[model samples]
Target: MSGGVDSAVAAARAAEAGHDVTGVHLALSANPQSFRTGARGCCTVEDSRDARRAADVIGIPFYVWDLADRFRQDVVEDFVAEYAAGRTPNPCLRCNEKIKFAALLDKALALGFDAVCTGHYARILTRADGSRELHRSADMAKDQSYVLGVLDERQLAHAMFPLGDTDTTKADIRAEAERRGLAVAAKPDSHDICFIADGDTQGFLAKRLGQAEGAIVDETGARVGTHTGAYGFTIGQRKGLRIGTPAPDGKPRYVLDISPVDNTVTVGPAQALDVTELTAIRPRWCGAEPAGPATYTAQTRAHGDDVPVTAELRDGELRVTFTAPVRGIAPGQAVVLYDGTRVVGSATIAGTDRTGRPVTV
Candidate 1:
């Protein structure tokens, strides 16, 4: 359990279903106090206590596993390195893939548990042919299928999402918790990245990578402004450029790219952000075969619009071709594919053709 209303209620629901349930809380950080502060975040000692209380109320055993070493190596290090490489990384997806599903699931199976359950707003469906598939939750606004799409067949087979079928809003969850007299009934949702307490990505990177002043240049490579660090900027960013000069067309300029080699942040017109095709690397298949080329919907970011796309396997990598142009398709982000509600697969975005090169479209 995550020590939140959703997970707490999920545990209660699972126990109500008459299954042998055990609550497992992951201690990902070295300092437990950092995870329990005010109304935000998890993985703290207090949150663990809350999770244990919820499990006790539901008449189940609860345990806290120390996964700090693995979490740092898998999620935290990957996040830091991705930013250093000038790509925007989704640490949550990495956590789901490496820590939760891979490590924790393995441990759960070893402990003789039938399946590991969580409060993630996604569903796992067993088809008529006995094949498992991942689907979006009933609540569209709380759908987290994009991040959970990274799970492979093995992980999906041993996973259970208790809150998937229930279309409960945040308010409904809080009300349910209160009705049940759960300890976390009034506990606030954990927002922002859990590991990073301060919510300052730029400041964190600067401390890790040291202060590296660089030039913020336009498309023509002319230095228009200066920034304290290149890791602070991301592609398609319009704010924080701190450029004193106005655009020639009297319009706002947007970040088109970040060249780590040159240590330059490239600014250009908004048109430069549009892309029709993107190359996704490190493809992961969830309960499906690697069928050659197939049509599916691809979502680049969480809460972003899903675009009609054609996915093809080329030289072992999945390349997605969007029917229309998409903006803000950043590298290191997960591009999740879905056939209606079932998640086909997902991959890390490697690059894009922002220049609008015409192909066989």
Candidate 2:
């Protein structure tokens, strides 16, 4: 259990369903419980206590599993490496892919458990043919299927999301938690990156990446400003350029690219961020691949609009074309495709058609 209202209620619901349920709180750090300072974050010492209390209320055995070494090696390091390479990563997705489903679920099966259940807001649909498919939650606003696009058939088969049904809203979950006497029922939701305790992503990167000064150039390659590090900037960022002078066209400029190898940041007009096509690498299908250049709704970022798109799979890569224009398409971000509510597939954005083409200022 995650020690939040959602997971606490998930355990209650599962236990009510008459299955043999046991609560396992993941200790994702090496430090002991005394070291954590009641931070408003997941996996803190306080959260473990909450999970244990919730498990007690639910009448289930609880245990804290120490997976600190594995998490640091997998999720934390991958987040740092992706930023160092001038690419943004969804560390939550990494945690779900590597630590939760792959590691935790695998160990659960080894210990004779049928499935691993959580509070993620995504549904699992099982076809009559006995194949399991991941689908968007009935609550579209709370849907998290995009982040879970990394799961494959094996992982999906052993996964269960107890809070995915349409009738079960966040309010209902909290109400259930309160009815069951869980202390986290009314607790505030945890936001921001958990590992980023201070919530300063740029400052954290600066400490690790260590100030590689880079020239901030416009589309014409003329030096317009300077940045402490190329990795600090991301595609489509309009703020924090700190340019001393106004643009010649009196229009707003946006980040077009970041070249970590050359240590340079390129800025251009907002129109430059627009694109109609994308090339995605490392495509992962939940099950078998579809037949043709099929049409599906595509999402580029979390909480972003889902646009109509037609995509074709070629040798494990995807050539995706949006029916309308998309802005700020960044490499290393996942592009998830959906056929109605069901997840069609997902891939890491590799490049764009205009990757090397400059946006003329």
Candidate 3:
């Protein structure tokens, strides 16, 4: 239940619908204090207690499964490695792909469970032929299909989202929780990287990767500032550049690229961040992979607007051409394709083609 209002309400609805529901809270951290505590985190000890209380109120079985090692190897370590390699990764997406739907589902199926139901704001539509298609939730403002874009066909078959088809808002969900006597009706929603307790990503990376001094350079290969580590910065970052040399035109500079190989951070004018095309790898489709090039809406960041793009699977990579230039796209993030409100697939961004300037350090 993740000790949240959404999951608690989802469990109640499933049980009330006459399904034998079991609430399972994943213990993703070996040490609870290492992760974010209280309402800001999901894997803390307090969250486990909250889940158990919710299960009690809902009259269902509750268990806390320890998956700390697997989470560390799959999501946590991968996040650090991606940052060290000069890439920005979405850890929530990785957790859904590797931990929730993969590890948890595998164990659940082996235990004779029919499905793993959650409170995610996404829908799965079953076709007449028994095929399933993942779609956005009816509540468009709270749609989470982007994070769940890694689910394949088999995963979709055994997945259940009790709240996806409802048009109610988050506040309505909280009200439902209160009506159902769920203790977490007013609990604050979790945000940011849960593992990082204080939300300082740069400090967290520095602790593990260590601080190695590097140069910050502009597009023309001129040194502008210095940084403790190249991994601390992300694409399109404007603040914290600490550039001593102001632009000759008195304009502000933005981070255009991060080169881990050269240990340099590249900054330039905002327009230099424009990207025309992108190449993405590790594509995972909700159903069968597309056979040819097709036009679809591409969403890069979570909660970001979707833009029209032509995507093709060539040489085992997703090649996407945007109708309008996209800025702040970085290597290692995901590009989720959508046809209307249905999620087509998602791929990890490997590289991008800029419009006017090079991304090299």
Ten residues in sequence with the least summed lDDT for candidate 1 = 352-361
Pairs that clash in candidate 1: none
How far is 291's C-alpha from truth in model 2 (Å)? 2.4
**How many residue-pair clashes does candidate 1 contain?**
0
lDDT (Cα, 0-100) at 34 in candidate 1: 62
TM-score for each candidate, following the candidate numbering = 0.96, 0.95, 0.98
lDDT leader: 3
* lDDT for each residue of candidate 3 in 135-168, tens digit (9 for 90 to 100): 9999999999999999999999999998998898
Q: Which residue ranges in model 2 land beyond 4 Å of their true spot?
A: 32-39, 354-361
Task: Report model 2's TM-score to 2 decimal places.
Answer: 0.95
**What lDDT score is found at residue 172 in candidate 2?**
78
lDDT of 3 at 164: 94
* Tens-place lDDT digits, model 1, residues 1-361: 8788888998888889998888889999988676537657777677888898998888888889999999999998999899888899999899999999989989888988878888999988898987789999988889999999899988988988887888888788889988988979888788888877777878788888777778988878888898888888887899879997788898999988887776888798988788889888899989766678989998999889988999998997888888988987788888999899889889988888865642110
In candidate 2 the C-alpha lDDT for residue 124 amounts to 95
lDDT of 2 by residue, 168-281 (tens): 778877887888888889987766777776678898888887997789999889999988988788888999999866789999899888888889888999878887888888
- CA-lDDT, candidates in order: 0.85, 0.84, 0.92
Better of 1 and 3 by TM-score: 3
